[model samples]
Target: MSAPGEKVTIARKQKKLTQTELGDNVGTSRDIIGKYERDETKPSIEVAAKIADVLDCSLDYLIKDINPEDELAKKIEQLSPINKEYVMAVIEAFEAKEKLQGKR
Candidate 1:
């Protein structure tokens, strides 16, 4: 619980949500959310679950000590070349669609 504050802060920032916004999503007040971020208080299991859902992060990520970016980078690096090409193709298709729409 002591260590979770920093990591939770990081996750919340990455999601670009303010304490008030996050609290709104979890049905809590900004003050309580601030306490969680400051490590002054630990959230109940239910509140934690709601926070995880609102933040689009795993409960483990908010509670346990883990470097989320490291794991994400590793997973991204593991994508196959063919899969990478497919992703690029999708991006190109979207760009083409946008250009076509803009010309209309």
Candidate 2:
């Protein structure tokens, strides 16, 4: 498990977000984002929460090595009923197509 800084960097990259973009989302500057990534500075709880929100991740994932995908699933679980139904339909369609192609 990596530290928060490494987690931040990983999540940011996974989301294909630039440091400037992430900082902008969190109401900070690119330099501050760099400092956080380098572990030279720690963000306050509010800032951390904002970062997590922008990154579509949980604070646990950011600070405690929890699986980020699990956090993503949690977010999906919170989707509106119609969106959830659409997502499930897409998943079922993909699965059916895969089965037809003999792919797991």
Candidate 3:
């Protein structure tokens, strides 16, 4: 497990949440979250629980130093449509632009 401070910072970043977003959910200022992330301050147990709940992560995972982004990515993938046409369109546009430049 990482030191408590490192764990918190890593969890926050893995959630892709800004300090301001986290603080908004946890009823604190972003500065407080920043301080926690920087190891300049520590949250009480109650605050830690709140943080875990708001971040939608298990306290054990947060404390035990698991990589949270994998779960987050899975959740995002579940929510997002697999739009092959959209992806292919973007790729085709990029190739067309490249060819146009070659012609110049």
Candidate 4:
């Protein structure tokens, strides 16, 4: 896995956030965000936790070499309840399709 800064860059981009936007949400300046993204400076654990929350990712993904998707449940936690059910249904449909193909 890359450094926490790389993970931050990836996740921030995935969220379609600019450094300034992320900084605004994370309570920092854009320059600080840039420093973090460039790996010139690391955020404190408290700031990192805030960043993770703003990015809708896990602190483990940022600091401990864990994948952000490892917290899949957290990823979908922001979805509406009905949307969450729809997501589950879609996963079930794909699994069922895979099973059918295997059986064939």
The residue-level lDDT of candidate 3 at 61 comes to 64
The sequence of per-residue lDDT tens digits that candidate 4 reaches over residues 1-104 is 68878889999999999999999998999999999988999999999999999999878878886655756778799889999999999989999999989953
Tens digits of lDDT, candidate 3, 1-104: 46666777777888999899988988898999988877788888788888898777777765565556776556556653566556557768999998999953
Q: Give candidate 2's error at residue 5 in angstroms.
A: 0.5
Q: Count clashing residue pairs per candidate.
A: 0, 0, 0, 0
lDDT ranking from best to worst?
2, 4, 1, 3
lDDT of 2 by residue, 1-104 (tens): 68899999989999999999999999999999999999999999999999999999888778786666786699889999999999889989999999999998
What TM-score goes with each of the models?
Answer: 0.63, 0.64, 0.54, 0.65
lDDT of 1 by residue, 1-104 (tens): 23787766877899999999999999999999999999999999999999988879889988887776787667767899898777679878999998999953
lDDT of 1 at 82: 91
- The reply for model 4, stretches above 4 Å from the true place, is 67-104
When summed lDDT is taken over every stretch of 10 residues in candidate 1, the lowest stretch is 1-10
What are the lDDT figures for the candidates, one per model?
Answer: 0.85, 0.92, 0.77, 0.90
Give candidate 2 regions above 4 Å deviation. 67-104
TM-score of 4: 0.65
Evaluate model 1: give its lDDT.
0.85
Highest TM-score against the true fold, candidate: 4
Error of 4 at 14 (Å): 0.8
Model 3 RMSD in angstroms: 7.9
lDDT of 3: 0.77
